[model samples]
Target: MTIAETAAGVEQRRRLVTAIPGPASQALMDRKAAAVAGGVGTTLPVFAVRAGGGIVVDADGNHLIDLGSGIAVTTVGNSAPRVVAAVQAQVADFTHTCFMITPYESYVAVAEALNRLTPGDHAKRTALFNSGAEAVENAVKIARSFTGRPAVVVFDHAYHGRTNLTMAMTAKNMPYKNGFGPFAPEVYRAPLSYPFRDGGLDGAEAARRAIELISVQVGATNLAAMVIEPIQGEGGFVEPAPGFLSTLAAWCRESGVVFVADEVQTGFARTGDLFACEHEGVVPDLIATAKGIAGGLPLSAVTGRAEIMDAPHVGGLGGTYGGNPLACVAALAAIETIEADGLVERARQIEQRMKSRLEDLARSDPRIGDVRGRGAMLAVELVVPGTTQPDAVLTRAVAAAAHRAGVIVLTCGTDGNVLRFLPPLSISDELIDDALDVLAETFRTTTVTS
Candidate 1:
């Protein structure tokens, strides 16, 4: 199907009738400043009226190429037909009955699907939640209950969530965690296998160092769980070196520490594989998933080994809207779309396209320090010429340029020096090439000096 036909039937081509964030969006921004809280930030002020395929139609009729995919949530596109139909049917039947109280069939179905789809062939169990943070918090609880331990281990550039405990687990400070402190205690941070910045340590050496630190500082016996993103998301799409994840999983197995894979941004065919952990054949003891789980609906889940998942008390694990009927149906539809549409393979195609273009760009731009990631989830880390010093300024400039030129790009990384690309799998090759053209021009015009 064509890109436009896929995304809500809007014309597939980018059309800029006015400047980015034209009059209508600017007026909305004014209203937002008056009504909305300041803490909640926006990447671009352009108000989205509609989105589908790979374009977000803004208030003033600007069709901007969507490379962010609403932060990797819309793997099947913003308005996948099946998800829309399922949500409509569920909404017509009922909106909320509080699954914790009444329960539902769709919820159970979602759990079953998650169990089957998540890595590993072993019998598994799943618990539903409203957000990635909630899933993570509950996963920690399950690990602690099962192991009788208090400490939770996370990596240096990890981003669990924004909740109290998850805030502690997350690594970044300014936006996500600054001043949000007195965060949950006993959350230990370990070194990650960041090849770009790890002083030339290979995957094995980095894993060895992390293991050594955890052994000395936190002691595996005291650790309840060691949570990591199979492919670190907000931390610049930093895919750990080869063997790092498997080695970590093996160590966790030996130590009885629950290996929790936070696949919030990398799951549901976004990372080529069904889950990022599958790339290394590492099956997590517990997997926290969200983002791409329910098309655009709010749903998250913790799927893991049966015994560990059952460790929580009968009543200790649920939320009022944990598995809202509407969200559950949406999740089921989204999963079906992924499987039926061959989105997993589509993600691989997107990766090859994006990596090829970015690598071509890198050959001429010294600031393009490294190009990394997998499937549709990819990134380029900017650096000072001839040095590994992060260049956040250049990153911001390029992102802003992309935005001005009617393309939506997102910036990430602990140092904020990386530009991430997460286009929808349903997006057409034509649209992707167009977005890359914008990126190429942005790089050409934006001065990057040594």
Candidate 2:
């Protein structure tokens, strides 16, 4: 057997034996269309059979480079050895005892790990959940209970989730909140510090603008929480100007509003720091995390100050599968992999390499308007060649071209004009180079028609 077939690894290179979707994947897509909900969309129609390291093997044996990391879920790489081993052992013993019913050790262990890892050294407690949306929902509930207030504030371009209350908090409209509204009440939207678009306002000044709006409309006396993604994820990896987060967080602390950091995408080792809030030395009163938490398993958490987290009544929190044993064990293993492998620094290395390449692309390509993000989570905003107008059509065309060429890239932003890259830290440098080469070529080929 070759090195790829043996214990060391799966094939690390991208190889396209057939077209992008091929026959096998197309067949699955056909079946899915007939059975699955039409409301659920697919980014790349190709179905993955096996995935590891930086490669995702589709049904037709095409090994594609993974730049999205399952939308920032598989941070330790797919089928990470430790996660697999732990899941296997846990499954043999038990899958779900329902932590609310007959609590399990893995569940407690996972909670302890979250409380220790999340930003802030304050006395903290954690409540587990199954997805990022659940964590955010619970965080809001906890904040409301603690403050005995009814109003909440969120920033522009923020994406919390799809549930009733979160949809009201999310800023985007079309795909995430078009027809699904008639959303929850008392959620207010504030301005965000978009440095690229904010002219040259410094962080503190920009934050002042948002604070003024919030105080005027949703006064601190009535506000329960202020929820925001440290680096806005699905809305575009919009890293706020320097000091923006710190200024806002301080205001919340003094005003008694629970500052909630939705690090669902920027948590773990994806953004250089274990938590993106650490980048600004901002300590949130509550943090909702999910993506990249369990090496692909579905596990999320709300970690926060003990008094705030414990404000809800005895039975006010928890779900039937909130802290499922299998997910908890997978989380423990994933956390160990992150610390032992030094993935935090690895993310910084990836940021340096990717930012260099993307910046070089921007220098030569006029359509590339901005290069932003940190660590493995970087993005480029595409604009009309001469102006700041969003070139969403060109963005979509280029992404399709990359998908065809065996590189998986995801697009985001309210205008759908930003291309974000979230590569697994386990990915090799060579693999990243190859993916960038494909991206460069895709831009070149698509720019001709644009």
Candidate 3:
């Protein structure tokens, strides 16, 4: 199969003729407020009319620099030629024929790709789902079925999903879990090796602490799975200290606990490596992946050891829309694009550029507490000058200022003090530098009020 070329007609520069929202976007926002649910929040009220190659053109023709990559779902860029062509062909042929009932080649093709790409060379199996949350929930189900255990372990500052069980696994309270309970049961929370706030404990020591807590509180035998994000996403792009993941994986292996890597955010080429767990040479028993797995299509999967994945009954897994043919084709095209375009290397280049710029900015700004993340997925944690106290106010102010200046940035973390940068791997260096300039100016001006 041949790779598709970049889309035409969309310029790759930031341009703002009208205000940020302009009249058209404001009108859309007004319509959205009245028609859409109030809970569906938007990072920017500007309605996008066209987007490609690091620029999202709003209704009023304002071209905004897209740094968020639609929350890391567009690592291959929106309107990726390969993905668009694949989707177009698939839609023309067939959209869906539930994999559970009438399986198609594209579905098996995507599964084969995932089984080959994910960490480890072990005999593997895969199950498709429609979202990250569905993949995660199914992973948990598989783990429990294989281990015959009831308890599942999670960590603080983790963002799994909004599903009942995942929401229970998640640590944050507001937005994700507020008034959404009661959540699932038997999901235990453990301490993560957050180097920034671990008070001097290194990765190994932090792992020891977490293992002790799990052994004492949840008991190793009762644990069905130990799920964690190699690099925590929404929880501020927190990359665990060195040796943390390896140590934890080691203990889980020795204790027969299924170690599941929640790579929903860190999977694909979003991280420098195809999988973040590859950074530490830790191969998880099960890996939940989505967001960037299928360009921008709604698809997810649980790839794991053959025995574990096959533990559930024959008809126990699957959904009505899981592994939809169109999404499968999109995923195949996306994986091909990643390989043909050398996006893995591109992600590393993005990291180098982003880190260099953000680190330089941090040198002059004390509020830029820490710069952490891997590959194209990076972030800066905001804190009070000379102290570790989170400065969420400053973070919001800077993000808002960037939005006003025609840049799309996203803030995350339990404290809402992290400004994450998940630019598409296909984005150009020039656009990245342009967005950084806006960020620098925003920080310089907004820090005073913050």
Candidate 4:
């Protein structure tokens, strides 16, 4: 199919051959080991030769269903014709002319799109960056500059990013924060409304408790921003209870603290809306976005109240390739695809299908302690029967078995017991069913470890 002719529905029917990594991918891995950095640790060994919509064709001709969406990056599907064409066209014309030096229309268009798509209609502005971490770092800088405060607050079990500042904000210690110490100071961790694990405290109560703790420890007056992920990503797919986000938003407004919603993993229609905060009717002061923003390109953005975004001195926030022409073009195409194609509603559809399937599995199997998340971003939390103890062994086994059966599955959570599904909203109903069957079969024979 030409770049212009491939449709989402037509693209999901592709099939797989040879196993995921077959000979071609193995050879590629060997070559990669020789040339690439040793820090790369892929969940699967497949070498993608071609991809479109919800399917990935490996070098060995195996077409595996993509349930992870490239770590939730390709929400519009891989190789979307419009995005591909836009990127190709932009690259041919001009690759780099740093926006800080000479601005471009594509960059402004992207920022405008973000301003409109994000919550709060009262005079919004946006700044683009190269990655989720960069967007997050800038959000903090803007908050600090605007509020003139020294401290920032994040929540427990949060996963912001890997950079020095973000690592300080990030709650996970292992892997992300280990050894990369001497983190930025004055970052505090507060409690979150994780109903599944934290007992005795509901949504509002949890928020109140968090606010009280912050007041006692950091003092809200000294806090510049309180960064949170509406749907906790790397801390596991833990969705805050109904009133947690709303309560926090109100608190931030009352205290003059900038509320930054780190929607890097849950924005751009991934969570059934352009941003997950919309689910709670909470309009954050600043919203940081990245993963799914550009349909697979490296693009991140921070959109917020005009006053707060402009607080930083002129030339205070930018990057050489922050809004690279190619990425900006891809974002425009991706946003167009999301709206024109109704990917938001499509995400809801995927959620309903997966929820129904997984709920049934949970009911039948005592191992599935909880199944949660909204829209296309959903997960199943594994636990010992009749208890809250995490069952990482069964979780690992189920994911491995699914891979063996030709479906890619990803695991997350501090305990490594949650299987998150980030399948493209454009994924077919049949493909969803097939992947579910593989999961069901995987659970049937897997043994649980305490």
Candidate 5:
């Protein structure tokens, strides 16, 4: 509301003193082109020098309202006071002795917190990792070890990660999996219950269809796990119809298949619930989480049934920097901040507020084909007015215009027509209101390019 420590007392508000990609940012981009790999594409070319609360200060000192939240990693807000303090204290004490070599209290504390917070009350154990992909890969390993199965199933419009095994689990082919294959083996795909495009199919029918396909195709007897994003992230924020997840979980339980929920994007109060699986009351055998776990620090975990997690031989899982002391402390502080701020309820309020505005926008504009998602994670699909034909050209144009106007927005969907909004819970309604206003105006002025 006032000033932020991240920017050395920079006021928390969107103030564009120069063009969005001010000269300084363009300079950095040029430098990046020569120094950094071409594969590392940028959504917003403007480089952020400082960020906190809902604002990202670019190199030219322009304050931009942050809607992306570093791709849902800063759910507790950027450089949050508690997280910063904890990391600072932890760093001064010791950076890392290697958890596997010499375990620390913070890592144990974080595991305890995740065990208590994740969906089920059933006896659970947690193992930390450095990224979402690692968490997912480990979950699969544990599941396979426990079940002695080789096959795994993932759904359409799903994004697991970019690792070799995760790439096999992921559905999209373009940026995530193009030319990078020879992906891992024994990964199968299934149909997802997409409400917007599924001919009004209900959750139960969708689940049945998917279950039958898995039965016929990747027989349950051979399947180790069914990994899914409770709400699909990069493949578009597709919330599979209500009963769909529950039915799948039940089938997995009966079939001796581990149900793995990849909550990388939807965890840590980003959705109204602490974990999106809670919304469906579906308990997963294992849940892989990363984004939003440690403010901006790289930390991920796979928490699940104790017996299954313990199935793998000792030393089968772990990394040198798996649970660095700094990251562990930051995670603890972030969890503390979320509970203290009542961020789960705040995320619900954000969902109501954002959906209200998005619905209003859709009413007047036929291009807005649908508005869906939960908590602070909302999205709008741009379409060709009368039909559900994706209008990707228009989508890209509008997002670029928003960035030019000092408002950050992201686009997803397999078709690239969905605009996702994941603002930090610490963001004020006023910032959201202003950003939406910019989006509305951008939509009004942006002409369909194709």
Candidate 6:
């Protein structure tokens, strides 16, 4: 449903609802069914008319707390004034010149911002793209060009993208990669240190095992790059143990393999740091960033050591809308807003609140096998009592309960037993408390056996 343009002086917290789907949203959905493709599936029933900092207004006129953060986009909040103004200004001037042909200031400005924001003190260069998948693919290409090798190493439960190369990089088989091969060649998978699942091995040990495999089977010298997610997003919000990242970084240094961190979901302060690599003090040879870079615009970037980035000859990298002025403007506004508004600190605040509340629930409930995450990107892993077997049934029930109670939550995990929380950093303390209360009530009241 199209928004009516909120009434003047209307408060942002109003939740007065005439109907959940309301008249307008249902009408729009019906039209959407015909106009839009059938590949997309929505998590919430109510259609959104408008969204701002931490709340979404449904076409039914109900106000709901935003917890999923648009699948980890809009981390700085939706419709940020700075982002809106920048986009408007750019649209008026010029939208596209194609950076490959005639470069624009906005593109270079964004690349500069990314260089400064990403980890590592070394000389860095950035190439902008339109999506995270594109960034991942380019990262592999750059790694190959730099190392003059063909083998790229990724981890199990990893999700790089939906493209051919990324499909090979991803671990899941049923939907993402299932019927989508013959995939790109020379991609190898390693085991990730999932402490909860991996038998009794510590973080460093997990990294060691993976290193040994590569050394024995593939031989690290032949590998071009090793790509990983600092905090795996689509594979489940899995935070690798303390020494895991550092160990991998050390291995890459010794082997001359480019260490690529796919920070597409964990970057831009979504995980409290400017980048998730900062959590372990591990600096990668390359980094791919997106999701929240432009507040909500389509922008992704590959930033890394200058020599490696430039290995691809001039004009080897770019797209028609690769770094469009409008998206670049949005990115500039987003970065400024993040710095000026202290969203990084805000992310820590959300993390503390989530940890305290969820840990308390874990202590009392056997179904809540684990509460894991860093910063505002957190999750609860559901499992059957006294066993590691995933409790997908309970996870689905609890999600449905939360929706009924007016809070939107999302489920993830290889087994679909993990409930991830990707709340906006700008969301209020009151909203956080309210959503946790709903979660607690859902857990307490829902019957697993039923």
Candidate 3 error regions (>4 Å): 1-8, 448-450
State in Å the error of residue 128, model 6: 0.1
TM-score of every candidate: 0.98, 0.98, 0.98, 0.96, 0.98, 0.95
Per-candidate clash tally: 1, 0, 0, 2, 0, 0
Point to the candidate with the largest lDDT: 5
Tens-digit lDDT string for candidate 4 (16-108): 567656988999999999999987677888787677766777788777788999999999988887898899999999998999999899999
- The digit string of per-residue lDDT tens for model 2 on 326-410 reads 8999999999999999999999999998899999999999999999999999999999887878889999999999999999999
Q: Where is model 2 poorest over a 10-residue stretch in terms of lDDT?
A: 1-10
Candidate 6 weakest ten by summed lDDT: 1-10
Native-vs-model 6 lDDT?
Answer: 0.87
Candidate 3 lDDT over 123-231, as tens digits, reads 9999999999999999999999999999999999999999999999999998999999998999999999987788888899999999999999999999999999999
Give the Å shift of residue 35 in candidate 5: 0.6
Q: Which regions of candidate 1 deviate over 4 angstroms?
A: 1-6, 448-450
Per residue, candidate 1 scores C-alpha lDDT tens digits across 1-450 of: 554454687667777999877999999999999999999889998999898888899999999988999999998999889999999988989999998888889999999999988989888999999999999999999999999999999998898899999999999998998887898999999999998888878888889899999999999989999999988988889989998998999999999999999999999999899999999889999999999999999999999999999998899999888989999999999999999999999999999988999999999899999999999999999999888999999999999999999999999999999999999898889899889998999999999543
Give model 6's TM-score versus the native structure: 0.95
Clash pairs, model 4 backbone = 16-63, 17-62
Model 5 segments beyond 4 Å from truth? Answer: 1-8
Candidate 2 residue runs with Cα over 4 Å from true position: 1-9, 448-450
lDDT of 3 at 294: 94
**lDDT (Cα atoms) of all candidates against the true structure:** 0.92, 0.92, 0.92, 0.89, 0.93, 0.87
Question: Each model's RMSD to truth, in Å?
Answer: 1.1, 1.7, 2.4, 2.4, 1.4, 3.1
After superposition, candidate 6 runs with Cα above 4 Å error: 1-23
